[model samples]
Target: MKKIVRLISAVICFFQLNVQAEEPKEYTFAINSAVTPLLHAAFINETIKTVERSVAPAKLKVLYVELPELERLIENHQTDFFISTAATIRRYQDLGARDVLTASSPFSKNPNRSEGSLFIVKEGRSDINSISDLKDKRAAAGRPTAFGMYLAAMGEIAADGYDPKTFFKSTQFYGLNRDQIIKDVLDGKADVGILRACYLEDAVNRKVVTTDQLKFINLKNDPEHICLHSTRLYPNWSFGSNPSVPPAVLSAVAAGLIAQKPVGIGLYWSVASDFTAIDNLLKSLQLGSYQRFSKEWFWQRIIEYRFWVLGTLAAFALLLIHSFIVSRTVNIRTQELKESLKRESQSFHEAQEAHRRLMKMQRAAVVGQISSLIAHELNQPLAGIKLYARTLQRAKDSGTLTEDKLGTALAEIRTDADLAAAIVERVRSYAKGARSERVSSEVSELVNKAVREFKRQSGERVEVKLTQAQPVHVIVNPLEFELVIINLLRNAAQALQELGVSNPKVDLTIRRSDNSAMITIEDNGHIEKETIAKLSEPTNSTKADGLGLGLQIVRSIIENHGGKISFSQATSGGLRVEIRLPVQEETK
Candidate 1:
């Protein structure tokens, strides 16, 4: 019975070994969808055949997934071996995968390396002649997660100072396929297209797109590679195994991939190449293994270098304090400047006020001087009126006066009284200052009135000759203007009287020149050059009893009325005064 039992055990153990041998080792192989479906299927078939030959009874389960899924599978330790680009392979390495081999193609100049992306546009598209022209243009690319074609294209664009996210107006990604991108560009649906390097060469060879229909953008001349590329080259796609995968399986898969012979497309695997260039590409783009630092990672780094972080914080605080101090200093200076300006403005206004007060006092003094002259002029008129009154009273008391004589004496008294009243009125007008009512007065009339008044006052001591072409009119205060002419005539009469010339004469001429009324008063009396030079100066006198304010007042009044006055030696050996006043238009 013991022998029979042992025989049963041995047969059962033999059957168990057979079952174990036939069950097959299941190995999940994950591949990123970096190529078209047809090529991916061929790659899968080739990979399966190579791995199955090296490790017998190995049932390789091929899983084609996008880059995200490939990464997930790697992180979850769900895949045994993965075939993907170097960028994705580096990500797998971070997830505890070991790179075993790299891919090589007949199209690659270096069998162990990969090439960059190709930027293409339609031929004759002059607006899109270069990579920089991609701004705001419609572009088509492969899958966004793709490394060789899409990420590589992003790196190239970023290197050229373009942000791939916003550089193009619109970007559409076709999953793991360049045919749609090429078609879109050709059909005018897209302005530019990006594909993995050597894609265009292969497409042209396959007759998918004609070389004449497309143009390479940012083409680099690499005689060694002899292929169109826009970015720097990186290591090719790699075959790698998960760290959880059995060492025996990893060894077998590595040997199988390296020994796999080139078949269709002359593609095969090579020994794993240095992925540092691929790492740099991903780092520059902040993609794959070198993705942007997460918040958790940032805090972790901060905790790792706490002393340096504290030092940076201290420096930042010091800089902030410095900025505050500078701001405070600037504000204090600005306030001080504002206060200084305020004080300067106050001082300027005080000076202006003082100057105005001084001008008022000077004007008052001039009016006082004119008052004294008026008082002196009134004294003779008053004395003559009193003398006439006394004579008339004496004549009436005598009772021997004839009717004609009595009438003549009364007339003389009336005339003397009228002259005294006129002198008082002149004094009142002069004392009233420069404010006078203005009206349109004829220059000829003003000149005749001034001459008649001068003759009445001086008893025709000087001959006055008046000449007028036409009736020239001017806007002026009649009283003030008449005062101006009277003062000039009075000065001329005095000058002639003092000279004692036999034929003392004053010639006054009035005419119109353009928009001005010209009045020329020429005297034949002798006047010194020094007297003429200072003729219009205030308080300057040619005569011992002269106030010297007459000519000065005349010039001031003429200038106040927008006229000019000038004194020159007359051709008649006397002083000549020219007054120009603006003429007023006559109304019909």
Candidate 2:
């Protein structure tokens, strides 16, 4: 009886083992081929084989589908589970798929932050050296929805405070031919190629992306990592299933994935990690399910919160009506108060204008008294200097003045003061029977010196771009000419800052416009042409504390140096101040 029972148990065990292996429940697994290359898809298919199907070890029926058509499959519930990028998985989750496992590696302790973007540029492309340099550059990438291929790189730009949609000159998308983006960059069809992190390493190993012509940009430190990347790491590829899939099967799949050995680049499946990074990335880019709020979505939200929304709106209506009644009651009285204030303002302005005229007269009288000992030509600027000094004293006393206004006013005083001192020194030298000191300098070289002086004097608030320059030489007193350039650059920068130009750019160009060397100072400010035309006219200034004699003094210096100063409307919508000085006879 014992022998019979043992034999029966052995027979049962063998049959059970045979039944488990022979009758495996097959599950359908989906892969988005548009975003996943052939080799990657194959690797993912191998991973699916490790998943278990409850009592019987599960087998996966791999289904390849385009990214755009994945939605159709999810809607029809054709695939039980799917393997895709975290970004795409989120999109599937919105369509009723739940994440089961996430791909991981030994590279990072936090397996979720294993995926990132790699920015590629041709080795010869020096123009695109960094992320910010990608502005107006043509970009090429894989599917629009792929995070590593597109959104990851664009997020870097958005984080830099630029609108990613319009940051690039243009963008092109290549569907399944993802590697073609790399080729596009090398062949000069695209300025940058956005690819997945470790893609270059894997491609080179597989002999896909060939040649040393490609270079990685914005490469972050990858200590103990397999490859270079441009952006911060995000969650890796995710494995998920349809909502209708049985929990037992999902648990088995998760167990199999976590148990599987590491694959390419040490990649293997691990327990599901936080996908909040992916969701946040989508939200930031306004892509995927987080796309810009649409009319339908808004209406859907309203419907969902109809009662609360109605209550809030009713309260808002009551407040608005009350406000309307209050505004009506106070409208006439407010208008009368406004009229009175306007009258007072007009009277105050009239008195201020009269006071300004009186001060001007007083300044002229003081300078005329001092002119007995100085030259007549120097008297006007000397009077302006004294006037500015008195104004500075008054501003200091009032304690309501700003540094910018003070700096600007003081700069004028300094420039004019230096000019007056130089003129007096020259006169003394003439009295001693000596000639004025001057030198011949290359325009490019001298202009550089002038720019340095301008930055030093005006501080670094303004950027001076010497766009183009020629080797032409000119005879000039370096002190006076540089001072003149500094004054003009300061004026241009001030106008741009005051007008709130996005980027205050003062482009300085030096070349032979005609028989003389022309130095053009143009800015991207919004000052009027009418204002620019009268900038050099005496007593016609734009600054509140200005004596309107700065440009007049500039004109005097240029004229004494045998040069002509002129102004015009710049193509950049700002003032264009041009100075033509005689070229040094020998160097020409």
Candidate 3:
């Protein structure tokens, strides 16, 4: 039985070798700094697992290169797969590298495509509270070319009141690898070290550094991820493949990376990496990481730095010239403004007096025009009172009055007196010329009330139509709104009566928009163009015996309520007046 088992194993190994020969004979992958050591280890492990599943021993080669070298390798077809920061992926694509998969660290997983730089130190070290404390102390950073590592550290060093170069007794680039720099800091080879955020995970797992020994210093807690990080974070590395490779190979590689533990990197796959911000950073740094800076700009900067002192002096001289020109222009304008102000101040008092006189005249004009209507309005309830009294006397004389009949008579008497009091109150208020008391009131109610009052007073032959988009509640003076509507309707009714139109019509409409309310009152009458023009003009009455004061009063009331009024010809041969008022914002 043992011999048979050994033979079967031997047969399986031979077939696997034969199958591996049939598969793609060769393939290579690239690794860089942003990819953690664990990811690298996992990728190799998963690759082996994938080969086993496929029943083949396909030989896979791995190449570890710094970010810049990786770019050259992919473009040259020296590697089949490349891993880089998202920014680098765009740079590589522009440089002829194909993007396949985006790699993520388990520590900084989904939704966060890139990690920032972290400044770690021994926990109990009091000598270094911040980057500034690193003065005269040795500092180590992972790869000067690795933007996240050094750029972030430099910014912190500057912010902590220390120049990155002058702040340290000695600063050195600790190889283009994170693990090496982490070890250097842990082994006491460096006083300060900057590492990518996720690199600490590996050091902790490997027992190379403990949380207590390595402390993250000057940690920034930022919203918008702009934490007061001792160092800024650049975009995370991307898992990509070389486009020069066959599509089949790219598919297999992408599939392998995406599959769970496909080769040995943890469960990580392609995700969208927005590197626009990082690109902006790289453009500022002028790093040759990409063609973001053209050769012309690079040479121009090189020349400028050579003569920076002279250039700065020249720029200062031009600034002074601009300042002198602006100062002269401002002085000239100031004098002209002073002269204009003197002339305007002489007319301010005159303007105020004229405004007061005009308001008084307007009030008198409205009172005259509505005198008959006001008398009629009051006469209605008084006449009802007289009729009710006569009926009550007749009933009492006929000996038909009972307790219920007397109660009814008293209630009718009270209603007639109340009606008379309201008409007097409205007239008195209008004559007082006091500003309308504004509050939130339903527009439809105000319009309907005005129509009812007009019909009661005039009893003119007219058709009234009221339409509202919705029950519009506006911040307004109830009295003022009612007054305006009444004036508009009365004007419309008068125009119809004058035209001798028996079936005259008045239409009231209210429209509500996002920020304002519009009220329109339209009438069907054969009004001449001259009459329409004179409607709103003060003292320009179109009626032979009319005061021409109704519309003017309406305009005043609406304007006082923070509104505007205008008149236009309706499409069906009539006058249309529209009033717009701002809707006060609702209190939360």
Candidate 4:
């Protein structure tokens, strides 16, 4: 029986080795159906025939898959090759998939910038003008995360300094039915529709929908581009291979795609070199490959351990007190037994106050150290409340307090209060050692809010101007980010006030520097270059009552956001503080 089993095992091993050594006779290709309707059965069959003929002696099998299943298939290396839209090409690359050739659809002459989005509103609708106008409006798109239909339009909203996640009041993520979205928009089923750029032109050309029926929001002014796009253009569909595919197979496949003529109504493949446009788009929206950076994972983990850290700190403090008590009791008991009962009792009670103040001093010092940092949290918001109250009083006295004005002021006040509370909660979270949360926030908006509050406080004492800016996004905790800006603005305002220039001006500028955002805050105020150099050493504050920690804290916060900050004396005798942060740039 043992000899028979051994023979069977040996036979199985031999077959396995032979299978491993032999070249594959067949390969499987997957098509993401959610990406395009072009990858139907006929197209897949045509592609398979061409690939198989090019790599002769090896057959190709094709399968259509939805986005979710497609991702899984590629992740598990269940498919040797795939076809996907440009939005997902980078995602697949992260999943160990490599693009061999780009599918240049017969629809567009420009394959690299072939795909984009159209924000469709009713022709008769007068309210919708731009992508931001779609906020709180009923909308139809293929899928919430679909590149052509949804994310592309949302990118416009984000570029305009608004949160895109909550743009639509109601979304009909009607999957794969691009035409249905348009139909729903026309029928008033949706207030707006998100559709692929060329699909509308195709519909109009085919007489399926008249050009007068739809209106595009935030229309691009690129006359050279064929499509009347509402968003920036991205690359077309792609041809990719799983990382597991042999290098030889990948090369053969690319050669086949590159060699193939326009087959099946001018369908063909073209090589694409620069996908920087698509990468910038994805980064701006914090989607696909940039999703990991968008998460506040660092702060989130700290929050989860917040209680444990706080508890540990408390336990350690208690342990210190317990050890001291034990030591004191032992010392006293060992020595005082030599004295009378009354004297011993008196000594123990007298020493009970931790030998009169040592315990009090140590415990108080530990607690004050912890609470000191938390004290700064409410300063900005409280100051805003006071400013608002003053503004309301002045507005009322001058008979300029309109209902809308009052409501706006009150709302701002409420928002500040909420932010103050959130800061408190965040401090608690940090104490528990929980990581803080960060999101892709519009830099202009954050800086603008800070400027507004600072201006309110300064009240014509210093002239503030935002002279230049670009649409840039950064992942940060919004409140903390705002506070950082507010602190800097306040510091600049203080310097300008002290300088006493007839036109004391604090000029703000923001722009893109490669993959980072460069923010410059300049004031016509003098500061010693030596002082600026030593600003990080914790002894740099010039103000007598200053804690001397403001700039250091600002630098630390900026560093935490994956950026650097520095101060320099400007040539004009003013202070120039520049902050650089990793950014997600927006396409103009």
The CA lDDT of each predicted structure is 0.74, 0.72, 0.66, 0.74
lDDT of each residue in 37-116, candidate 4, tens digit only: 54334555667776665444556777888777777787688988888776776765666777677766656666777778
Which 10 consecutive positions of candidate 3 have the poorest summed lDDT? 47-56
lDDT, model 1, position 560: 78
Candidate 1 per-residue C-alpha lDDT over 1-588 given as tens digits, one digit per residue, 9 for 90 to 100:
546544544454344335437665677888776644223356557877766554455566878788778888987899988877767767656668777877776556574456578888999998877778888999898777677567877887888887767888999988756789999999999998888877787788788999899988888776656668877777777777888665555655565565556667676777755677777777766665555365545777899999999999999999999999999999987997889999999999999999999977867775666565556555545666676677767877987667787677677667656655765565556455436568988888877876776675557568889998999889997756766787788778777777787888889999999999999999987777887888766668776766556666666678879999998899978999999999997679
Off by over 4 Å in 3: 1-141, 144-173, 176-353, 367-373, 386-588
Per TM-score, what order, best first? 4, 1, 2, 3
- lDDT (Cα) of model 3: 0.66
Count backbone clashes in candidate 2. Answer: 1
Give the C-alpha miss distance for residue 252 in model 3, angstroms.
11
Q: List residue ranges in candidate 4 displaced over 4 A.
A: 1-21, 34-44, 54-56, 205-208, 221-224, 296-588
Worst 10 residues of 1 by lDDT: 8-17
Say which prediction, candidate 1 or candidate 4, comes out ahead on TM-score: 4
What TM-score would every model get versus the actual structure?
0.45, 0.44, 0.43, 0.47
lDDT, candidate 3, 265-292, per-residue tens? 3445555546655555555544444444
User: How far off is residue 19 in model 2, in Å?
Assistant: 16
Candidate 1 local Cα displacement, residue 492, angstroms: 99
Over 4 Å off in model 2, which ranges?
Answer: 1-26, 34-43, 52-60, 106-109, 206-212, 263-266, 292-588
